[model samples]
Target: MRTRTEENPDYCAIESAMEVLGGRWKLAILKQLTPGTLRFGELGRALPAITPRMLTRQLRELETDGLVTRTVYREVPPRVEYTLTDAAHRLDAIMSQLDTWGRWYRDTVRPGDAERVT
Candidate 1:
């Protein structure tokens, strides 16, 4: 994966941030991680659309971003859990704001408003 700086010399902070968490499953993974740590199987069940290989790939990206931590236990069969790092917890506040804004938009906007667009 290319570093954002290498990808864009004049990149703004929000663009850099989006590069980290803007994938199809990234934000959904973050939402699931907020409740607590979860095993690979649990995450798989929570997001039925994602395959095992894809989940592993996305988790690795999140780990690389410093937004998530993966722990392994040396049990009979290796037990592992994924949890959000401190950096990711900061997203909670932002997500909450987005939720509020979404509700407001849904309440105030009509579906036919798109007719005005040309």
Candidate 2:
């Protein structure tokens, strides 16, 4: 299979990266998964705003993109866990930078509402 850069040499890298991480919930999900593996219910509880269907879709997409791994255990009640892959771990630095930029923007550019809340 041709790699993205090989297939579309002219495509902007940022656009390509956004294609994989654009959705509202994907980044949040990735942030939550950064700590360690979590079960379906655990993820759901952690992200109370996400519906079950949306969470499932986001997880499947993340898995397809090789960012996350899902394992199913053989047990009477059944157990499943999701964890970040090595490639996903590489995103930690980027995400942390983004988080810093987000805080800066919130404090410097758009401060009133967030400041009031804090």
Candidate 3:
């Protein structure tokens, strides 16, 4: 249920970003992986709502995009872990900005006349 959108060549940057992180689950995936390497089961437990199949698919895409590194260990039970690569650290600054914007939105834009947390 996806469609290509190169129709507006001028929006290459927007499209490119979307191509990388465009999905309901991608950001949550990145956030969970940001802390450190984790086993598949650990990731699954941390993100209770995400199905194992979907997490596997996202991990594969992130590995292909050079954002995540996957390692497998040879053992009886078998072990697999995923860690964020240096390239993904670039998101730190962007995430900080997003945090600021979120605070601003909650303080100024959100309605219902709720009291500010600050």
Clashing residue pairs, candidate 2?
Answer: none
Q: How much lDDT does each candidate structure score?
A: 0.86, 0.87, 0.79
Query: Where in model 1 is the C-alpha error above 4 Å?
Result: 5-11, 99-118
User: How does each model score on TM-score?
Assistant: 0.79, 0.81, 0.74
Give the candidate number with the greatest TM-score: 2
User: 116, model 3: CA deviation in Å?
Assistant: 12
lDDT of 3 by residue, 1-118 (tens): 3334444367466775677677767767777888799999999999999999999998887787778899999997999999988988788677668668877986687576566433
| lDDT by residue for model 1 (1-118), tens | 5466346546477777788887888888888999899998999999999999999999999998899999999998889999999999999988778768777777777787975433
Candidate 2's displacement at residue 3, Å, is 12
Clashing pairs in 1: none
Model 3 clashes, total count: 0
Order by lDDT, highest first: 2, 1, 3
Question: Which candidate model has the greater lDDT, 1 or 2?
Answer: 2
Candidate 3 lDDT at 84 equals 88
